[model samples]
Target: MIVITAPTGNIGRPLLSQLLESAPAAGEELRVIVRDPARLPDTARGRVEVITGSHADAKVLDRAFEGADAVFWLVPPDASRPPHDGYSGFTRPAVQAFAAHGVGHVVGVSALGRGTPVADRAGLVTASLAMDDLIASSGVAYRALANPSFFENLLEEADSIRDKSVFTDVVDADRRAPLVAVADIAAVAAGLLLDRSWTGTDSVPVLGPQDLSPNDLARIMTEQLGRPIRYERQPLDELHTTLVGYGLDEEFVQGVVDMKRAKDQGLDAGVVRTPDTASPTTFEQWCAQILAPAVRS
Candidate 1:
């Protein structure tokens, strides 16, 4: 049996879709822990067993993990709490459940910067790494998909791109770093969940095919969308103030600031992309297919 959490999220949705098509052929039964079963794809309805509720809930995890051989674990972002509570605290119950239920393999979504100099101070990434440690201690074979930023993050600026032909970020325009598509992350997760052939407890870096700077993204967006898109660098202080102004917890806001600062300091730059580490989706393809449609809409 295979279990998936947050099956309706960006990464989980695609992962679930891939598993729906492939798991049955692999003799795996599918189950999902979701807050609202209504949010799941209509096709998933008579196919996978549904455990309605938060996966962070001990009771929900108990039922979901029982008889499950593998689990695709993902913690939904919660800006209402501190970083530690949002990641490690949310995962504590599931760690116990994993040991109790004897679930063999677990795949989790996590950020880059595990062993880097900035890792200890990288706030949310630090908490996420701690969560990985908590899970690994459960004796399950765990593989944390260590990822950099996502191309999909640009969707948040779709309106700005459409209206002003601009996008903003905390990083410098010339700072090149790996960026990936969530679909690629989902694909990697699905592959690991299906073939749990090897794993003790380690991270699998899913760096995208190439490193891209904000300026490079702007140039690609301009060409792809047929508009004069430009990159604007936002001050880190301004980002922190803006997030806090939106009523996010102060500590969580700090976490966001720390993560952006660390990224700017090359925390995510430590990983060299190899054929084994690189994922297939390119930023150009994503901008044309995903961002273009969003900007047009």
Candidate 2:
């Protein structure tokens, strides 16, 4: 049995489908941990067994991990809460449960620059690195998928795109950094679960086909939507206030600013390959295929 967490999320939903489709035989079971089973689509609900509960609940986790050969784990971000063990209050309990359950293999969703110079800048990234350490200490065969920022982040500005015709961020307009699709990340993760031949603690960084900045994103957005989309760089002071105003903790806001500075200084510039690992869909393809349609109506 293959168990997946955060099944209703961007990656988890598709990852579940891909696993069920690619499994060697028809009887291969795919299990997903969900807070509420009723929210799942009829197709997914019909295909997989739904274990109801949050990832942090020990009872839910134990039941989900039981009879499971591998698991995909991730902690949902909660900026409203105070910073606790590695960005989320749930990581410690989740990791502890994985150890207690003796899960054989795991593919964890983490961030890039996990072991790099500027890793400490982002509280979330710093915490993710720590989470990976805890998982490794469990003595399970593990792979932490170190992913760059998701292109889906742009969706956060759906309202801004509609009202102002611009994309906004604190980072420099020309500071290019890699962005990967959550789909690619999910595909790589599924591949790992199907074949747990990996050994020791390892990090699989997925840098997308190219590095892009706000300006580059704007150009692509404008072209795809046939509208004048532009880049708006928020002032650093205002950026901090904005994030905090949105209910994020002060330290989390500061950490985000620090990461932007790291991006400006080119600290996030690392190239990695996922050759034969998975087929990566490009940003343009994502825009043409996903974003454009969402924006059209």
Scored by lDDT, the top model is: 1
| Estimated TM-score for each candidate | 0.99, 0.92
Highest-TM-score candidate: 1
Candidate 2 regions exceeding 4 Å error are 24-27, 84-88, 273-279
Candidate 1 local distance difference test against the native: 0.94
Q: In candidate 2, what are the lDDT values of residues 140-170, reduced to their tens digit?
A: 8889898878888888887788778978887
Give per-residue CA lDDT, model 1, range 79-132, as digits (tens).
999999999999999999999999999999999998899999998999999999
RMSD in Å for all candidates: 0.7, 2.1
| Candidate 2 root-mean-square deviation in Å | 2.1
Query: After superposing candidate 1, which stretches have Cα over 4 Å from the reference?
Result: none
**lDDT scores for all predictions?**
0.94, 0.78
**Superposition error at 217 for model 2 (Å):** 1.1
